[model samples]
Target chain A: MDTKIKTNNTTSEKIHSSENIDEQMLERLFRQFSQEIPDDGFTDRVMKSIAAVSQEESVSQKTAFSLKAQIPLLKSLNWFTAILSVAIFLFAGGPQLVWNSVFAPIFSNVTSILPVSVFRWTFDDWLVAFFRQAHQLYSIDVLTTPLPTIYILLAVLTALAARRLALLTV
Target chain B: MPSVTDIALVLQVVTIGSQRAFATLVERHQEPVRRFLRSLTNGDEALADDLAQETFIRAWQGLRSFRGSASFRTWVMRIAYHTFLDEVRKSKPTETLDSNQRIEPNATQTDNFMLRHDVQQALDSLSEIERTCITLQLIEGQSIADIATISGLPQNTVKSHLMRGKQHLTTYLRNHGYKD
Candidate 1:
């Protein structure tokens, strides 16, 4: 290694009597002085950073394929929207129907006997308005007439939420 | 085996995000890159090692751009050279505040307590390009053409830097009792 490092740069030289500027000698000294320090797990540390960075990249890639994210577009949501509407109505309307048929009469009788001046409890106006709006929404055919933009927004939001959930679990 | 065989293979594995294969590449190439950075930083082992880590990280990110136009070692050397330049430029202001900041690698105050006053005096005085060219040419035993490629200087420019750097180094050695 030392012998091969000798240079042939002889364009000029500064020699005084027995002394001379030597490129070959300079090359040798450079090699000798440049000591190689021992590597103490330098590679391991680098690999760890690489692992962390690559893991982040893979997570981003996985998020690209999230299930809920694939639910946009009315064409794709036709079946899902129908099923979702039915499930929503079942969960929301079930108690309402029971309340209207059974609880409303009982409540009315109880209130009639207990309230004249003190017990003045009627259904909250806001609650009634919310349920009324919910019923109107339930009556609309989701698959008919160019689907409301709110449904698309809801689907996108749900997809994004699903993606966030997937990332958290990871 | 050709050096590229190991580098190219491990590079493939790393592209698919395999840390193990990337570790192999790191292990194999760490010595030269670290050693190179060590000289560039004038034996500031900590800074050199940090820059070396940065070099490998950059290499890993830019692996796909390595089109095999040069050997992996040369490509890595190129990255390290640029990294060193960036570091030097970054550290230049602080270098003035402390005179001992830019000590020669072989300072008489450090390991080589007996090294005379003329130690790398000429090498120290050379321009950064000259210092880089000379270091790579001499210590690493790289060819002028390879140095040119690594430094992104023209071949002729590399030769000129090498010639001028050697002349000064020759004078520095002679004054320090280095006999031909």
Candidate 2:
């Protein structure tokens, strides 16, 4: 290749000391540089890589498809679990066991922490006390003062709407 | 074969994952692809071939996305250009042609080694975009629209690059004792 280039260069130099710079000359020079690159197993290597890539893609696709296909099965299993739990709760004295093992302990812990008089009050008494506290804090019967209640309700709704809008914007 | 169109080959590959069809496409376009990359890499044939291989592989994987609005060769060359750009971004090599590797193809003889050398050196004198535009326009015979598509440059920008790049090459050649 070197010898050939040297011979060509010698011949071209002998023919013309310097070729005229023209559009044709520029194209010719570019063509000389942009010769066809011989494919010395380039296609083979590319094909091999493509084959490996395809295999990897297919494997991942198959795994993804399988997972997608299992969605219904997983959903069905969820329903089955719900039904089984319901059945066990109904047929196996589940409520009593739960009350004894869970509610009783939790209630005991709560009662142990609070005053005994707090739990002694009826549901009506608790409700009355809550209303009395609200009336005391606001200096009016909130139920009787519908204007304040409505304004407060609107303010709460507006605040909630503003919070929701802020969240969406963020 | 000459009878089989690129679209037909591409369809076969897309529909059935035909390696044979893709292989034909690769072989058919590898020369221009490699040549384009070689110019971009300043005649580093090994790097050019590696980039070419990657371009073909990407073309194979992305065959489905090819809408055939452009010719398959153009699409592959676009891939090759992007692949070259990605390498450039990763490497962050010298900005000027003067700082880059010298142009030397491991192939057939040229009529003037100094002219070829001067041509590459002149190309190196331009900015990367200008060099790309010049190489695509002059060497690869790509049109302004096609060059824009390949390089993701605006048509006007490509035009300016070609203009500036050509002016630089003309000046360099003139300075190096080439007349007219």
lDDT of 1 at A40: 86
TM-score of each: 0.60, 0.64
Q: Candidate 1: where are CA atoms >4 Å away?
A: A1-21, A60-170, B1-4, B93-99, B102-122
Q: What is model 1's DockQ versus the real complex?
A: 0.30
For candidate 1, the chain B TM-score comes to: 0.82
For each model in turn, which proportion of the native inter-chain contacts is also found?
0.61, 0.54
Q: What is the lDDT for A84 in model 2?
A: 51
Docking class of 1: acceptable
Worst 10 residues of 1 chain A by lDDT: A9-18
What TM-score results for chain B in every one of the models?
0.82, 0.90
RMSD of each: 10.7, 14.2
First chain TM-score, candidate 2? 0.32
